[model samples]
Target chain A: MSEPIDRKTVESVARLARIDLPEDQIDDTASKLGDVLTYIGQLEQVELPDDVEPFFGAIESVNAIRPDQLTDSVDREQILSNAPDADGEFYQVPPVL
Target chain B: MDLSTLSAAELVKRLSSGELTAESCTESFLERIKDRDSSLNSFVSTAESAISAAQAIDERRSTGQAVGALAGLPVAVKDGICTAGIATTAGSRMLEKFVPAFDATMVKQLLSADAVVIGKTNMDEFAMGSSTENSFFGVTKNPWSDQHVPGGSSGGSAACVAADLAPVSIGSDTGGSIRQPAAFCGITGLKPTYGRVSRFGLIAFASSLDQIGPMARSAEDCGLVMNVISGHDSNDSTSAKNDVPDFTQTLNDSLKGLRIGICKEHFGEGLDSEIESAVNESVKVLESLGAETVEISLPHTPYAVATYYVIAPCEASSNLARFDGVRYTHRAATAKDLTEMYCQSRAEGFGEEVKKRIMLGTYALSSGYYDAYYLKASKVRRMIKHDYDSAFEKVDLILGPTTPTTAFKIGEHTQNALAMYLADIYTVSANLAGVPAISIPCGLTSAGMPVGLQLQARSFDEASLLRVAHQFQLQTDWHTRRPNA
Candidate 1:
């Protein structure tokens, strides 16, 4: 059996993820997260040989490079059309200050 | 004859003969969605432009112009795929109002093939859950039984095809999102080789495992769509540059001497008895068709769900971090500072499951715990792939249940996230190994829910996988069965 994740750890992780959790819901969320961690703890039982390499993706394919050339793919107006808050020329975001 | 009941292949034949116009075919599907979609909730939005596009196709045909392969067929796209000028929500509130100004490469290919775009179908939020219940839009009910869930994150795509809302649909699979729901909804869905289909416009969940494929009433129809969608794209770096074969060419090929491996691990405990018997009966059918079947052991199979939970969520955590209240995502209306706005926006925009996964991924990928969790899971993922590599050396393909059990009751797994994750046990390994796999309806349970038989093949060898599934579908009547609703 593994150690259950405490509320402090949950809070720390939520902070790292940039998500805010209410204090009242922290305990419940911690316990639920603990359950999932315990379930995943089974992976620790697999014996890995020293020579085994971790697999990140499927077979490696060589990158394709093309000659640099000027091209217009997407129109500037089309690109800005989906922005939630956009001025006539640029996206409008809150002031950095 | 009712146009809604016709298969994509049959519809294409009629359209080719000039007996039916594309406009009439698109209108029929749109009318069906209007009539039945309220109860099923399969479609998130219907496309008005689809009618105009179909009318153009009819005009082209009248002028004796050549039409593409999938002319006049109405196809539904999963909401996760971007469609130009259409709202492409990944079933999350974060993208609820976000519309892409450009079409996904697959959507462009579909239009080039002259297939009518029906609309966007609903799905799990950000392609996260096994049940469509996680969608911010609302849960999509199983067309077979309204009380049950349509398996997800591709649940809406599967349910739409089964209920005849659209003749065919496209969905992405990252750890069985497409195959599991297809099993539950009694339709055929394919998750091609990791890079067989381009991922240029698919919203990423796990980049290494995500693949977009076809979902339809038959494997033959999937092949028809595959011919149009499969090819290399310069936009997606991971997409394979392998030559695209005409998948429909082998649909009628004999399966004599095909070696099929029945993984002992897949049939073990927790599999429903009805599904087990149905799968066993399917093996017998394969044997009678002259294919050799052998019992093989994929010893590391049990660890697949555990490894997937770690790796997928970790990748998702990083992928979804882009939604910070900066450029185009949901922003908090009231915020004193940037950090507070980022925190509050993510907390409000993401659903419970998405947030839980983000938290879990954050913990796994965090410092001090990275080696013990993320690194360890990656090593185990290699072992899972090694097992499949060894099994494929002896057999041409692997066969098993698509899901351990059929579709469960809606809200059954909402509270228990681990239980929901376990539902993907039979399907995740294919994604982990970057192989091609498919789910086709094999049988129905005593309660009348559909069961799917899964088949997996070597990387980029989707031709063999589709051939076997097509032959089985030809001999069985399960694919022909429809819901009473």
Candidate 2:
């Protein structure tokens, strides 16, 4: 909980979430998040056994998949129909690096 | 006859027996949506196309053709679900105009079973907030008290069902999104085991904890809907391949010898007195049904809220990265470069709460902090799951208050994010453990708001969960009580 959440850190998180935040709001959010972190810090007092394993995913299996089955799906036009901007066969977007 | 007041089982019976035509039920609900939803703000999009769909079902009925199990029963889907040409916003402006090309696997299953989707309901933007206040559209008021919030990210779905706008609505539970609001509004809602239902079309929030389940007036209807929606799906790699049981068929079995565990941690200090009474009274009803209750310990419960806050947002930060403007959804109004465009689009599209979570999650999972915060939290989450595993060894099911308090006034906790986050204290543990849990109406506060009692069962055991919940519904009429909207 003592870990500091600064503006740059907040901005990086927004980027990870794919939401662009204004430079100004970053510091403000960092402070507010600091309060939330301080609140969550209360959990540190709860003691548990050393051997107990931490839970990361669901109790069940993970990423269990099957071979790609090509079944009839909607056409590209229908699939891309709602894209804000798209070319004839592709979703149009600004150039990516 | 108000279509909203009817239960799915009742409506399905009438539709099947020809006592009520599918077209009539569709028209009634559509009319109710037109008349009430403007003020309630429950539905995001209504199915004008449903009239034609209903007429087709009517035609089939007249022709003696086979109709699906839920045919003609009106269901409201959470906006997060892909509805094939219908907008699936996940209540964020980022995907405002994004309509899915294909139906979600659950949607396809419902259609095959003959469930007529009435509309898509509103939710917290990206399913972040406890109250629907975080929705990009606007806040959804509790149907019981218009000034108070309907608990959310599934708030709108819960509100619609509460006000009788839709017979049964579907909501996705990431934390307590579905069950909390169901409790707040005095309805029955279930969050099945993580892989029990396919998440193929659900807009990803925290992929690991997210599960789409049923919200309706009765446990039976929830079981009915669960039976239809639960099963394996190739599209969702995580969906379980096990055979789904007939939830309704096993619902009435006596809970005579089944053990119900009551956690002392849940009935702790901060819980509202009214909620405590409601849980106690519901337990009495269970006792009347001949089931014995045993006090159980979930010592790690205190750390559950903290663990969930770290884990859910950490995953959401990763899952939501797809919303970048370069690839999809919102684009900047004006930008000098691609970077500016990406940033501006995101800043403008997401709501404040969503941004807050992104920041929190990002910080926790950041390079320097991951092991200390995110990894540490994951370890606590494992302990929480272990707590449930240990408790289940002694009892068949666990019961407690769904939310410590009933729905608060709309703007009550908006300024205090942590207080609102704490509202999910009792509900998040189940999500962390990936078990089947349900919230059913047990009692109401003096202010007339609903109080929900939550019951949880081990992995893939929704059958027992529903049976106990259904028996509770049978012995008590709390679930049948409705808000006078």
Candidate 3:
């Protein structure tokens, strides 16, 4: 259905999603993802009223904002305890040149 | 009496009365988990703190310190909900070893209500799949049939209740994660109105569609759990500011003159015959109890699955981007650069289904495809909500089969992800409509597998929804039957 999402497309989408797909697995991934997209493609048949606005979430309420004043936060050391590699004050990551 | 077999409400009552000590109560359940869960695989990790916590609760009760609502009943939490000092994986390898620093708002509420958090239940990896097969942990088997799947994402939660591993559980539903599993496992599961419960520490799936709710053996237990969890929170902007009634207060309300809608489209193709008869019989039972059944239509029902796949994964892609190995969870051992680190860590950390969904979402939200996919699905999502809005005017609640069939054998749909997604046809619309829906066992099929009857009501109408389901349970013995462990 809809050409099984060719390997090239899988490669492109994987890049966008930031998941590195090994070359050997690309074809299988494309086909499986393609099957789901093809089913989702059934949406093409539903004719909607031209005036209907796209609904995002369940709530229609305006954003809830709070005072900008600084408040108590989780302990920095405790929060950093979950970090993969944390230094004294910050998380360690691959250095960007 | 096996303490594990009692409802969460009964356990709370007995514990508060000092008839059952919290230590003995927690230990009995911990024993159940220890003896039974090895076969069910319902728990990813059981808490070692449970006994000591129960001991503290016993001391508090003995000292005349006021006990909270739950009274120290052990409640299983879906792995996605953060539990401070406990490993919360969401069944993904990405967070396999990551322990949270703080409990989720609901977990905090459970603690405040005097419930003991016994364990984190297994789920589909990142709550992506229909079966629990996608968990980084091993697959959770249906207690009724070992070869079959416990319907997923919330499968382990359902299994824990079905197997009496825990009297009640917390589960998050994005699509049909909670309802479908509960249906397959023959337990009661409620997906409260989208904002009825706070989502402060739920590991996000599809933010809009995801709502945390309860799973148990009966609607009364679900209502009891809902009482402890539902309410607006300052931390969750989307949580409704509406007044939350005591969820359990209305459980015994009469169903006299209640209006139940029966949608013809729901009983259409792809449904199994046994499920059809079970639900049809349930409607008759409801009518016998003075409820009225009206024929209604949810015209947009056909488009729900398609719309959900697009919206859920799109939200998921954005939500899961936080897992890119820099902070919490899995990081790649080797990466040449930051981009490679992000890509490779995600590639290695996530399971196939999670990655596939992320890719599908990225493609849908990609430059040219956004209007055609995400925007169109959103508009159809409006129509799905509108369908519910129109139906609610005709009837107080909508009833249908929770899933097309009973528990399917594990690995049956693993290779066919789309087919697995289609199994959620009847349950996803409730999420799309942002209404409250519940699944309760109606009867067993000819094959001896359980069938779930689903009911949906207008948003924030969980009280009425629970009341109606509880009324049905009062007249039905299906809710009382459990798999022989």
Candidate 2 Cα outliers beyond 4 Å, as residue runs: A11-19, A46-48, A59-63, A95-97, B1-3
Return the clash pairs for model 2, or none.
A54-B379, A55-B382, B4-B164, B70-B114, B71-B114
Better of 2 and 3 by lDDT: 3
DockQ (CA atoms), all models:
0.65, 0.57, 0.76
Write the residue-wise lDDT of candidate 3 on B382-424 in tens digits. 9998999999999999999999989999999977777899989
TM of each candidate vs. truth: 0.98, 0.96, 0.98
Instruction: Give the per-residue lDDT digits (tens) of candidate 1, residues B23-115.
Output: 999998999999999999999999989999999999998999998899888999999999998899999999878888788999999999999
* Candidate 1 stretches greater than 4 Å from native: A62-64
DockQ order of candidates, top first = 3, 1, 2
**B484 in model 1: Cα distance from truth in Å?**
0.9
How close is each model in CA RMSD to the real structure? 1.3, 1.7, 1.1
A1-97 in candidate 2: lDDT tens per residue?
6555777767677776556666777778888888888877766776657886767778356556567787786787776666667787877666554
Q: Write the per-residue lDDT of candidate 2 for residues B139-176, one digit (tens) a residue.
A: 89888989999999899999999988898999999889
Cα lDDT, model 2, residue B293: 98
